[model samples]
Target: MTQWVFDLGNSRMKCAPLQEDGRLGDVRALGYGDDVAGALDGAIPAAVTGEAASAVLASVASPARTAAAVDWLTRRFGCISIVRTQPTLAGVRIAYADPARLGVDRFLALLAAHARGTRAWLVVGVGTAVTIDLLDAQGRHHGGRIAPSPRLMREALQQAAAQLPAHGGDYLEFAADTRDALASGCEGAALGLIERSLAQAEQRLGERPALLLHGGGAGELASHLDHAMLAPSLVLEGVALWARLGADG
Candidate 1:
């Protein structure tokens, strides 16, 4: 039977065919829209051919969107499972007092980072929000912080200040125009948070933590980070690992 793993975030849906050797193959990404449903319909069949298959999902979307997507997948794939944020998974313990309150994407990303056997990590996810979670050598979460991503910051400024444009211009050291100023300010805020977190992690842990950057906005922010490693598919990778464990059990 073919196994499929999906990561459904607020802005995008990513899915892949899980190979027998536990690697993802020909991953497909679709932005949120009516076309997403149609794309999945064709993509799944093409991935698995005519074999029996099941789908595993990790989602952080609204209830309406999740329900619609699950309903569609159930009709097409027959067996479907949705993974939740547990207190602990794959040896990584969540720092949240109420673990369920934590985003599963963050939890999954931590799992992926721990799986890499890194000494310690500062997993930074830059999407609708910038989330920084610290994981220690022993796979224990040391809490995290969340801030508005650069895109959200820009949008907020545009909404709150009529003079500011929501989209335009490159990030400049000192911008002369409204557009570049907005970009610089927003992006700088994100970078500042990450930089602060890195310092705090080192101070508290007594060693520097390796940075793992992921999510759609990571590329833009990564250019400013000296040691950040791009790990765009971490959540999806974690979803696949979760599926594997479930299959074994």
Candidate 2:
């Protein structure tokens, strides 16, 4: 049977084929719109829609959206596994006092990073929210922080002050116009948080951790970060590992 993994984030859903070697194949992302069911039906290949396939899901979306996805997948795949945040999984140990409170997406990202190697890592996810997580060399999570992403920040500003446009402009030290200022402020805030987190992680680990960037907004911040590696499918990669380990055990 073909195995698939789905990661449902706040804004979109990412799905990929899980190879026999426990790696991810081509990933497909579909944004959540008015007709999520229709979008899923159209995006998923017909061959993979039958009971012959299996699926694993890691979701950080609303319960309603998750339910909608689950309802659809139930009719398509034979078996489905929904991932939850565990205190410890594989070799990674989560730091959350209440593991269930931690977002599954962040937890999965940690899993993928630790599986890669025994190096301290700073995983930054730039999507609906900018999430920064630190993983030690021994696969121990050092907590994390979440803040409004640049896009969200802009939107919030626009909502609060109708004069501000929710999009456009460039990042500058000192923006000449309102559009540029909004972009600069929002991007600068996220950048500052990332930099601060990196410094704190370095101090706590006694060594600089490798920066791993992911999510839709990562591209905007990647150029500013030195030695940052982009791992767009980190969450899906973790889902594959989770499924593989589950099958093995």
Clashing pairs in 1: none
The lDDT values for all models are 0.87, 0.90
Best by TM-score: 2
lDDT of 2 at 242: 88
Q: What are the per-model numbers of colliding residue pairs?
A: 0, 0
Q: Which ten residues in a row have the lowest lDDT in candidate 2?
A: 32-41
Candidate 2 at residue 230, lDDT? 92
Model 2 ranges with Cα > 4 A deviation: 247-249
List, residue by residue over 50-161, the lDDT tens digit for candidate 2.
Answer: 7788889888888888898898889899998899888998889999999999998999899999988899999999999999999999999999999999999999999999
Model 2, 112: alpha-carbon shift in Å?
0.6
